[model samples]
Target: MSHSLQHEPAQGVTPTLRLRPDTGKPNVRLRKQSDGAYRRHPDEIKEDCLSQPSEQIKLDISVADYRVVSKRDSEDTVQRMRESMKDIPRSKRAAEVKCEIIQIIVMPQLVDMRYLQTATDDVIERAVEAHFVYSSIYLIPGLSLAASMCAAFHRDWSWNARGVYYRHYYSPHWITGDHTLWIPTIDHDMFDHPQERPRRERAQRLLRHALDNKRWTKSEYAWEADAWSDVFGQIRDDPALAADKRECYMNMAEVYPVSATLTGKSEMAKRIPDASIGLATFHPQHYQNAIASYELDSERLQALTLHRKTSLISDPRLGESDLVYPFLVYEAKGWSGDPRDARLQACAAGATYLDMLDALARHPGPSGKVEGAYQFAGSRSAQVFALTSFGSHWHIMVGYRRPRLKREHAGHPGMSKTVYLYQRVWSGLISDERKAWELLSLIDQIHEWGVTTFRDYVIRHLRSWHKFGRMVWKGDAERMRAVLGKDAATSGQFIIFSLPSWADGFGTDFKAELRQKSGRLMLKRLIDEQAGEPSITCVQGSCRARGYKCFSPEDFVRHCSSVHDNHSGESGRSVVKEVFDQAASDMKETLQELRANCYEIGPEADTSCAEQAWTMVHDNTCIESPTRYN
Candidate 1:
């Protein structure tokens, strides 16, 4: 410990370097380059290094330290830094770390009227092409009334489309034929104007009042009925003296004019007496005085007038011929309590509403040369009419032809034969060349095959074809099992049948013989079953249990046989095997045929029948079927 380890300094180096405590460790020190001085630690050396600098050397200081520097120097440094940063690419900086600077630049600009003109031209061109087309001859009055009503109700009242009204007078049918010819009364300027503010507020208030009232009543009016009557009485007594005031009141009341044109030299127009003016006449003087005296702006007054006139004339109380020039009259009486029964009778008799209308439209008068009245009973008092080109009775009908109730033999409580009659009639009606030919063909086939009812034919075909459809699609048996389970659950009963243990000793061709024999036996059994008198109602034991129900086991078997015959066709022996192998396929085809026929015959008839059938099935809650034992 007393002996010191010393190393001699190199001959060319300075001797002022202090020795490290441990000679084995290297000496570490801080130095300043400016004055060639050494310090004990790197921090001290760093401080000295920062202080000493050459002409080109610049100090990099911490932000805090830089702020402590003289304000003038700090400002100069910041300015220089900013100028340097201006040259750097902005994309290179980290989004979060980058400095943000906002700059505002003011510049003068000029606009070209020609450019605006071109833009406006393009907009106009687009607007013109997008214009909608409507039938001018069919819908003008309704269209105008609709527009006026909307304006009056909205109370953003304006009559900017007065030119359209003038045009309506010249060609009432023109706007009817082409609804697109009329422009919207509410335009951009009128809608946006500050002047519309008060009217809009008033409209809102009125709308709120209407909503709260929930009903239109005389009490809702600001003035009572008697008060209004007194005002009217005053006008009636001093007609000329208070003419201007009366006109103002009427205008404020929002009444307008209506005129009907006599088209194509009509004697009907001349026949209409002048005394019949009533509500139809639009007194021009009344409208003018209202507009002038009420201090109402031109737009508000015009809209009110138009709305009032249209509404007054359109009222049914004005008389049918007075407002609606073309009038067709119909009367309904002497029909069965059940509309369907009446329709069935009509169809079976080879007369229908469609036939009547077609004939009537072709002939107007009772002359021998003219076709007779095409009249049929429609559902209840509602009679639909088709207008001739010149408002005359072209056709008339009393009722829509429909299918009759299904009978018990076809697995329903109604008359199956009567039902079939209606189906046949519908088929004939739908067999028109214009539509439903394929469906008609299917119906013809069903009828030819002697199917008991259209519903039976459809259901039987659906069941049969559905199996085939599943087979063709290679559907999962498990899925079918699940569906069957669901059906059983909904039906609240299970279908149970036991097969015979041993096959009949007929040969490989036994199936064919069995099928034929079964069919014959089915028919014979049906005849036997019909021999017994059936009961309409049931006692405790019930007719079904006693084997004297409307439809017996034999009747059901015979139905199956008839269906099989229709399915198999007349090919005889081969058809038996074919039917067995492809019953589902045949069924699917039959179902498609049924559906096609049903569609052709029109949905109204088919839907009614289906709904009734479904309703009956739903209503008959009891479910009981005897197990087949062989």
Candidate 2:
């Protein structure tokens, strides 16, 4: 019977589309009975004939030929592997060279996702969509996402130092020409102060114990946590010191990477060091007290924060993120670690720290003085030290930037370029007892320099920068323009007045102006229109001193009255009239000059002179007055 699903006509009927099986066809087979053989047998063969393969042939390859083929394939694989290893370094160099100009797109959404542990494909797609939406909603002029097809590239100015295959390779040559520029010139006497003798002895004893134990050999962490910890204790303060104490100098291990502190061209691994030590952030009470001591308002605390944010004035970290005002850093390696790599890391970290101090000195304040107020070595030069260690050997290195020459005039030569140097000042082997004692003594001296010299230098410069900012903010319109340059036009609004010293403080009653000293001065009342509260300028004819502003009406009135005419009787009255006439004449001339300079003011003005003064004063925050430092 046929086994088709279709109905058949009958048992003997033939199908139209299907063929019948042929029973006489040949069956070719491979049989392995005792010996391997391929045979073609007749369709009707019996089981007894299976062992007698009448037509058969053996078909098999030798093991030696298989081995030869396998060896040939393996050699090809090895050759490819060899080629890949040789091309890897060349590929890296080519990539770095191509990145001479890097294009960066900083989307807030993508940045927020950086710390996420895991994310799905859909989540990433959503984040990208969010970034596009954000960019579309917050469009900035000249930076439109939709405007132009042209691509923008930001030049990697330090690209030379970024590539390992490049000649510079982020080494000392990139910073300074002479490798030995500062090494031989280090003042050895600076580390031998008499006050450090007691601590030196203590550090010596701790160092000896650390060296003899051999406990640190267990691991790199053991070296840092145990051996190094004990000696550093004598070099710094007790670990028990309150975090808020001003003199709470201590060591911190492995601070989180601060990308802001990276110097030169690259934001690479070298920017981070193993350890850092410096003054702890002062207690809020101490900060306020210091401000009070300087006779400044408590609100002035914002200046310090701003300074730290804009420049490396203090430690790169803001608020309460581990260490503050770090002056020393440690870069270490294990027993088998390469010393050169440690030194390079130290060089990068130290250069960044010193760069901050250099920034402050380079910023000539409103008084047009640079580094004139610094008390140690010289004002222009800044130096920060580091400790680079590999196993038992350690070196004390100093990163120094020479004092930049003051521009004799506006066009001085060699004033535009700055150089930085990294040099090893001292070295020691902890295994040697004498060298260990010397190392401990140097550590104490370095810490002393941090508290005394480093602290004072930072404080002094901060004072100068802050005081100069306040001076420019409150000074006359002329001085404001001089210091702020083009920013003075838009940063604030101003109006000039030639009112006599007796005009009762620009229309307001003298007593009222004094009573409301902290109040904002309105320019609309003076100009007889809806003018915004522009800064009020009162000029003194030919006085070289910065003229006063009506924002501080009390000071302006006292300045005009007392400074112009201090004599008694009719003679004083005559002198006052002459000064008043001269002031009026000077005011008219100054008004024309301001107009020519396009000092925009009036109803559309957004910031008033009083507002500008407050902002500038707060921006450059300092705890002490600059005069005290000078």
User: Top model by lDDT, which number?
Assistant: 2
Alpha carbon lDDT of residue 410, candidate 1? 23
Question: What is candidate 2's local distance difference test score?
Answer: 0.41
C-alpha RMSD between model 2 and the true structure: 30.9
User: Which tens-of-lDDT digit does each residue in 61-117 have in candidate 2?
Assistant: 223443454466568878986676675686585554342332233333332333321
> Against the true structure, what is each candidate's TM-score?
0.13, 0.41
lDDT, residue 35, candidate 2: 9
- Lowest lDDT sum, 10 consecutive residues, model 2, at 160-169
Model 2 misplaced stretches (Cα beyond 4 Å): 1-205, 212-216, 238-270, 279-284, 287-312, 318-325, 365-377, 402-419, 471-559, 566-630
Assess candidate 1 and give its TM-score to the true structure.
Answer: 0.13
Regions of model 1 farther than 4 Å from truth:
1-577, 585-630
* Count of steric clashes across candidates, in order: 28, 2
